[model samples]
Target: MAATLLFLFVFLSLYGSASCRLLQTPLLDHATTDPIDATQLPTSVEASPAQVQEVANVSRRELGYYTTSCETGNPIDDCWRCNANWESNRKKLAECAIGFGRDAVGGRDGEYYIVTDASDDDPVSPKPGTLRHAVIQSEPLWIIFDSDMNIVLKEELLMNSYKTIDGRGHEVHISHGPCITVQFVSNIIIHGIHVHDCKPAGNAMVRSSPTHYGYRTISDGDGISLFGARDVWVDHVSFARCTDGLFDAIMGSTAITVSNSFFTQHDKVMLLSHSDDYMADKTMQATIAFNHFGEGLVQRMPRCRHGFFEIVNNDYTHWEMYAIGGSADPTINSRGNRYTAPTNPFAKDVTMRMDTPESQWQSWDWHSEGDLFVNGAFFIPSGAGASSNYGKAASIGPKSSSLVGTMTANAGVLMCKAGSPC
Candidate 1:
């Protein structure tokens, strides 16, 4: 067949011109709430397991399994929402990131800030059009917000590195008090905001750049709290009640990507490890795409502990307890999701080996290929280990759970308008 389609187009053009060579690494060297500050953000970098299997084979050949068709068939929102000039190419949404955070180049090499003061009073001298002073500026930015606002932080809003808060066409809301604290530097990109009721502010002074400031403590209220972060990306955001965990990547966060977000009432709706013997979270790597786990969630749509995770095409209508859980040996790889099961009959099993004990987590690998399970939902997979560790949890390569409800139907925070075609 034409030499297997020219060897799959020369192996996806050398895996999209491979590149991810971080080295000068170091993490978890302090920050038990900033002792003397040096909360390790010296340009952090830690990606080796053969560079996370070559960035999970270049995010499974660029977020795999799409059979064409644009305008919301959701290939990262058709790579730019059919832009009628997406608010003047708002940094083209940082090149429409794909799995394994496709090198989150947020702030795409710097510029545009905006924000226009939404008041936080002072997390240590933050005042310029606030949002904590466009996330403690140092350089690269792309902030944008000037309209609908509601930011409310009295602490914990520390962020730095290449940024990109870009709350598309306004309606931004970093709710009820302290939230957002991506520690350690990295290319970050939190888009279209609406992070819910997060409380638990810090114990005092904060500020993460524009010449550092410190002295913090007491902060567990996560609405987005990735510590020791790496290239990250959270798109189309929205979350509900969160006194903790509405997205919590831990101590050794890796190339992450929480896409088309939207979570509900919440009770630990997301938490990618940093415990079970920290061990640098075994070089974490995430990619929970097209999210939507709506209405009163309870478990951890993401409760992983150790490493790789790539729950794809998400949409679990609701959950009361189990919708995907884990412990130390993490390596989940659920694909093309669509769970929907919660009449409580003991939470119809959607996997939760939390306190691990299936004779040692049945070897812990946990894979599920084209998921769908409606109503009496079920999924209890485990250990499908080597295919080279399932190619590092197969970053992404499934798109047929009946198209995951039109690719998560506008998953969240997308009310774009500036000449149409959002």
Candidate 2:
């Protein structure tokens, strides 16, 4: 009986060992299926949790995601993204991506490029057969109007897609028609340009309506009109003596940064409007910092909607009407803005007064509606005794008596003279 039991045990052990060996062998293992064709795999399979986790674990440095070197070798080097000489060689990298096994669609750069012209009458328009060839070109571009030449008309310079128009150390005068119009675009940058005297052409008065009246008037000609665009940056530019608003960015456009610019002599210096039928919620984010707003004989107002705006360290002086108008549900964080008036004319301090005295001031005062946010600021009233008489004086009054280190005052001066970090 013992011998028979031993023989049975040995047979069982041999069978178990053979089975384990077969499982261990790569050739015999059924779990090891053939390599997968990535293209053939379903999107769900490709984006499995395990694969996503693996990709997430990859450091940006390892993937060369934000590396300055990576921006180079594309069709257009977005110099704004990185400051490197290799950015100029982006076209080479794009060519390589297409010629090699890399995806063609993935090789595409941004929209726009920089065109250089030193002579007048040099047409910046696209070549024949390409009515708007330059328009469709997927590259962010700029035209450096040299000091030698003058641009007579820059109308219909429709910069669509991710693009920019940079005037490098030159003066561009758009006297006859609309200076520059940005329509149906995103991620744009316009800097260091001088735009002046752009007169509106056709149907200026016919399109008049309560909500859309100002948009089409002859005085509606603007230095820059950002219509249906997002994520725009306007820096170090000057708009002088315009018929309409110097810079007008309206129509649900969000994420705008306007800084280090000088604006003067316009009906409405910087008007941000949100009329009815505009689908965008009033709640957008805007940053207006270190800008000089003043020297206009007419009304200079900045109207906002439901947005959070940072109006900091701006030098505002000499305006006919309200300096800053926040009729929209705006959380205006006003800090360190200097309000100065000329000694002779002697203007009234910045006040939130309604046009109609009979109307409840609180109803018109958007701040009272629980949207305005003020911190660490100053208010120099119009007249000597007017400061004390103004209603809601306690609320609009500065929190801290000292202006030192409280507001972002003279920021432009700091940046220019001391070379401080901005």
Candidate 3:
């Protein structure tokens, strides 16, 4: 009887061990899923082993970095090999083989410059006269225009999926007449271009219009505007001498990134508008980083009308007016921004007068209003009554505040420029 009982116990133990092994296999299988195929993935994936080894490597490449080749006027392809960065490599291939004007405009090679002749039609389609369309119906089209040529359209430059418009640099300037607009485009990138001097043909008061309204007003023109677009990136671009804001994303534009750009000579440099009548579902997120603001001789920094925005690692100098302004709300997260203005008597006022004084020190008011996080390096106004005007740093996290003063500083000679008041 004892021998039979012992046998039964051993058999039960064996069964439990087999069951445990079966459970473990699935977890191990999941952990060992097949490596992503380079060809199947987006062009962002580099086929090199170095990229595979560092998961963060791909993202780091996308954030603005200048290659030595780009500075030396060498072929972008050669430059990519020298830099050992994915962006440089992709840019090189796009320029040399793809012939997308990598050399000219702002491209590293400076080839394939846009011509400003008004008589020239779009290369893809030559209309009888100048090209004018309310909606764009093309993908991966490269539009290059000389500095003098201004492509004015009646409506949005509507791009379909996988479409890219490389400005080549400031060489091409496209101005949308008051009615110019875009809607429902995805996977789009507008880079290395200078956009300005556009006016909406309607009224700012009217929220929406079938024919003419907010964007219709000449006063409402935006440099690079995105509406209802997704997975969009606007990088290494400049908006100078515009009548209105430099960059704006409104009306349900999701997963947007605006990085490594410059804005100046405008009322509001960057604006993310979510007005009352224009109700956007709360899932939209924006990453605005590493941008330089000022020197355009403009006023009012960036106005985020309403949205969840992560503003980080930006430098602002000679912000002729308010460095940052926007609605106070739960969605916006302003972090790691540096603001510098020489004569801000109101610096003390801003710090002391607000109902929530701690929130006032921030470049924007999202934290006090109920944002999840807000804190970073802020340069105190020189004449403020606060004893430590130079470095009264505050942040949600000590690590974030640690970055203050290291990168933040008063505008230097290069940024201030001649004839501009420092």
User: What TM-score does structure 2 among the candidates reach?
Assistant: 0.53
What does candidate 2's lDDT look like per residue over 1-422, in tens digits? 99999998888787765554333322211111122122331221112223221122122223221221322211112223233332343233222211011122221355334344422231243432221233334554433332423444423344555444444334444445555665556665665566677655433322111122122323357777777666676655666776566777777766666655666677667766455335473645565654656465345446555454545445454566556664433444444344443333334435443242423334332321111112211232122222221221111112111121112122111111112111
Best by lDDT: 1
TM-score of each: 0.34, 0.53, 0.51
Candidate 1 structure quality by residue, lDDT tens digits, 96-189: 7877887899788888889888888878888888878887888898889879988888888988889999888879899888799889889999
Deviation from truth (RMSD, Å), model 1: 18.6
State residue 306's C-alpha deviation in candidate 1, in Å: 7.9
Give the per-residue lDDT digits (tens) of candidate 3, residues 63-146: 221221122111222223234343323344333211111112122233332334444233224243332211232323333433
Q: How far in Å is the alpha carbon of 127 misplaced in model 1?
A: 1.5
lDDT of 2 at 308: 49
lDDT for 169 in candidate 3 is 25
Candidate 3's error at 146, in angstroms? 8.7
Two-way lDDT contest, 1 vs 2, winner: 1
